[model samples]
Target: MSKRRFIAALIGVLVAPLLTVVMPAGTASAHGWITSPASRQEQCRAGTVSCGEIKYEPQSVEGPKGLRNCHGNVGRFAELNNDGKGWRVQNVSRTTTFRWNLTARHRTSTWEYYIGGARVASFNDGGAIPGSTVTHNVNLGRTGRQKLLAIWNIADTANAFYVCVDLNIS
Candidate 1:
């Protein structure tokens, strides 16, 4: 190749990846966390559990919908998937109120709560934007120490946000 053409091609190859890194697809416009019951990320953020990079971005455990684990299937926050991480199990009542603190609200499809892989409760939003703080009074029918999974499904995106809370239900 000619000198000028070769240099231009080299620059193009070098800058393309940089541009991709600089501007990733589907930038996160909205994020939230289960703040009341203290999800695994919250435990990391509160220093109750020694965790990894998830402590820095607790509200970013985002992944595809229908995932059953904590960390939202994201590798950086994989520490959340460790059930033996000594997460503080908060004592709660049979009917507990779960709260979410949103950084930026999105059109929500629904909010689901699960225990032992079974959905205990869900509130359908029908694709409506929610407030900064959302609450759901869910009847966690079962008792004893349980790992509860909460999911925030976005209406317009193929991804969903996930958080897991260790609860000692009475």
Candidate 2:
């Protein structure tokens, strides 16, 4: 066979095997699922209040038996100011931001905080939960810690929510 023809045939043969390999649609190759909340009840639980601040950790359900990192739930983690101010605390008139450490299973899961039962802010932790113990920063007004909860909204599996933290404003 001519050199060009031989090269073309070789290419075709290699490409055919790859194209024929059945790739399950929607199959996640990444290990781990989002371990967030499943319902509003779990997300609405009070937060952990102490030292003029409220801290929380979302609930993570045991994922499907597989790679430790392969498959988890979706949830939210948050911290609120519980200084008896409500939504506004120190700083008078200012908007502050914090770099919070998070522990997530999915590579695209996110964490958000709510004020007065409204979605206020969110952060993506590069798909890694801050493990069992990680504190992420959040913006809060000069108000004592109020009713706030972190959430984890998983897409698949039994929708689950956990009030991993609660707080009482001082």
Candidate 3:
């Protein structure tokens, strides 16, 4: 083989693997979802709630923050926002712990929980990288059936993951 061709081939072999390793590390793969109290996506993942694409990727219901949709207004995950979709409400107390399972940790701005259009609780992460698991104790304050929308806002991105948890408060 020609010396130039051999040199080019050697360069390609060396650069390709390095690119693969560097690319994946730099690519943003932030993922997280509410697990305890069983968010809509969690229920779908657990086979307790029948859903669409979100059933396979509970940690991926991401969109811009300030939107109150469970599927983050994404068409593929719209099933999560369906109020009549027969999602099972877990029995909860006035105060319950909401747990987040982070598959790919990201720097977080804040974690917010809402019920009936009012934010009930929030935790500020202050742009710090979060742990594999995060928890927030929320006080629902209201009795009877309710739906809670939890949002995880990413510090570096203009996006947030949304999880809707149905609760039957005692």
Q: Give the distance in Å from residue 86's predicted Cα in candidate 1 to where it truly belongs.
A: 0.8
lDDT of 2 by residue, 26-81 (tens): 53222221222111222222321231111222233323322111013332222222
Rank by TM-score, highest first: 3, 1, 2
State residue 2's C-alpha deviation in candidate 2, in Å: 56
Residue-level lDDT of model 1, residues 62-122, one tens digit each, is 8999899998878888889999889999999999999898888889999999999899999
- Residue 85 local lDDT, model 3: 97
Stronger candidate by lDDT (1 vs 3):
1
Model 1 residue 90 lDDT? 95
Q: What TM-score should be assigned to candidate 1? A: 0.83
Query: How should the candidates be ordered by lDDT, best one leading?
Result: 1, 3, 2
lDDT for each candidate structure: 0.91, 0.35, 0.89
Better model by lDDT, 1 or 2?
Answer: 1
TM-score: the better of candidates 1 and 2: 1
Candidate 2 whole-model C-alpha lDDT, 0 to 1: 0.35
Clashing residue pairs for model 3:
none
Residue 44 in model 3: lDDT: 95
lDDT score for candidate 1 against the true structure? 0.91
